[model samples]
Target: MDNIVIKQPRLYTPLQIGLGSFVGGPIAMVYLLWQNFKTLGNQNGTQYTLAGGILFNVGLLLLLPQLPSNFPSIVIPFVYSLTALSIAATWQMRRDAIQHSVHYRFQPNWRVLLLSISLLIVWLGCAYGLGIWLDALGIIDLDGSAITAGKDELSF
Candidate 1:
């Protein structure tokens, strides 16, 4: 019998997965928000937004390890803190809105839906663009490598 070799596809690295998730998390959040806004009405918007924002921040934190070391630590903390504050404030506002019932009617807001869709598209596009830019700058290689013949071989 003759010896034979087999090759298997490589899985994405942690950093790559994190970056991809970071890019996707916000977009999906926005879409869900938009859908909630369209279908659920204003009373539900604040609750949905608050919950979605928290989840988005958590996803961002997961991506922190993949961030470039050159990134400023202060920026991440500031953004995270701001997001947390916003969530808290929104929760409070929703509570007040529910209590007062000051003719607060729930209505469909199309503008917000449009904005959400646009923002999601822009965000994902920018993420992909950044990946390309990083590759161009040789900061990171988007295409991974495979082990072959007892050596690492770069894949295109």
Candidate 2:
């Protein structure tokens, strides 16, 4: 009797998704989820993930400033990571298991690392742009005028 070899699809584990969420925030979560949906040939899921991710990101931006100043910095990342993990497990894990069982190979860690770093850079660029916009609108000053003034007074 000959043994047949079966090939399994590569997918990201829920834990990996969660870590990506933690490191790259919501963008990474959205991307990982979208990729899974696309791979599974779930067009509806792909569309919904994109739309939901946009709404969630907008809502998060709007609500973040409303949080109390004393809010712990760690809580936001924790919440998003847990949410990503839950979503990945609920929507994709079942298919992942049903299709490949224990034979599935996980997506490479290098891809996740590259994604996290790339998204982090994108996030920082957005922040910088927002700062420039706010400064232009006179909402906040980004220049060093106040520091210069203080130094001038002290020098006298």
Candidate 3:
């Protein structure tokens, strides 16, 4: 009898994260980070992947809401667009691993996923809350109304 090798789908990648970030928001990137933490350890470019994930988040939480909300909100999509560069960097780090057979059919670890997501929720909350606190304390206003004299306006 001959042994068989079955190829499986690639579940997550920087490109995947980059694209998913647009459609799925931070949750998708979090999933990729969780996958990275589980499968790879301090691999070359791991920092970039992690940084990409974090930056994706911060860009959304800290920078996106400035867009006027009266119409289709481009904040999330726009932020994700810029952050994709960070995620792309990680693709190099993951190249070998992604091509390996081991990663193809491996079972995703649930504990790591839960941990990543929980930490993300707390981290995002704190970071976002800090922004709100700064606005409240008059340190810097992120509401986009400051420039328009307290009225949110759509502008190019």
Candidate 4:
């Protein structure tokens, strides 16, 4: 046992700050994960993010279709956590690969890539709340009914 060493597993990463804040949704998450896989594959592939991506896709497949506009309050946090988990796990794998001298850089399109990713992040973050807020503001009719029909009413 003297030659054996145990490593404590880390569950989160600083990457979650940007990822969760901006790309913390099903579609953007999957795209980011795909980028991760493609980038890492060019260097040294890691199956961890692939599995996470699969899980995210599967979740999207099953839960996305059935989700109502008014999802549970808990769902946002849950999905954010899942998104954070994926980014954190993949970042860890990427760090490991880079430490081992795996070099993979897709040059010549960095500007386009940056602009697109920035647009995507902003679009996603804004879109997530826009519809709900619009509905809340009565600018959009969700089946022609008031969402807050009884929200402020006191029941006896």
Give all candidates' CA lDDT scores. Answer: 0.46, 0.79, 0.56, 0.48
**Model 3: per-residue lDDT, tens digit, 77-113?**
6565446536545442344456575645333445335
User: Taking the tens digit of each residue's C-alpha lDDT, what string does model 2 give over 1-78?
Assistant: 498877876778888889988898777888888887887778998999999988887677546545666999889889
Better of 1 and 3 by TM-score: 3
Residue pairs whose backbone atoms clash in candidate 2: none
For candidate 2, the per-residue lDDT at 138 reads 65
Predicted structure with the largest TM-score when compared to the true one: 2
lDDT of 1 at 70: 96
| Candidate rank order under lDDT | 2, 3, 4, 1
Model 4 stretches astray by more than 4 angstroms: 1-24, 42-78, 81-84, 87-92, 105-140, 143-156
The TM-scores of all predictions, comma-separated, are 0.37, 0.74, 0.46, 0.37
Clash count of each predicted structure: 0, 0, 0, 0
Better of 2 and 3 by lDDT: 2
For model 4, how does the per-residue alpha-carbon lDDT over 1-156 read when each residue is reduced to its tens digit?
A: 589855433222224323442434444444454454554453333355557656754554444435686877566546654655566464535444433543432222343346346745654565545556656787665554444655546445
Pick by lDDT: 2 or 4, better one: 2
Our model 3 lands, by Cα RMSD against the true structure, at: 7.5
Off by over 4 Å in 1: 1-92, 95-112, 145-156
- Model 3: CA > 4 A from native: 1-24, 27-31, 37-42, 74-104, 108-120, 139-156
1-156 per-residue lDDT for model 1 (tens digits)? 497745321222222222322333455344434343434245576566667766765566446547776988567544433443354344323434433544333223343345445655766675677678766886666664322522643444
The better candidate by TM-score, 1 or 2, is: 2
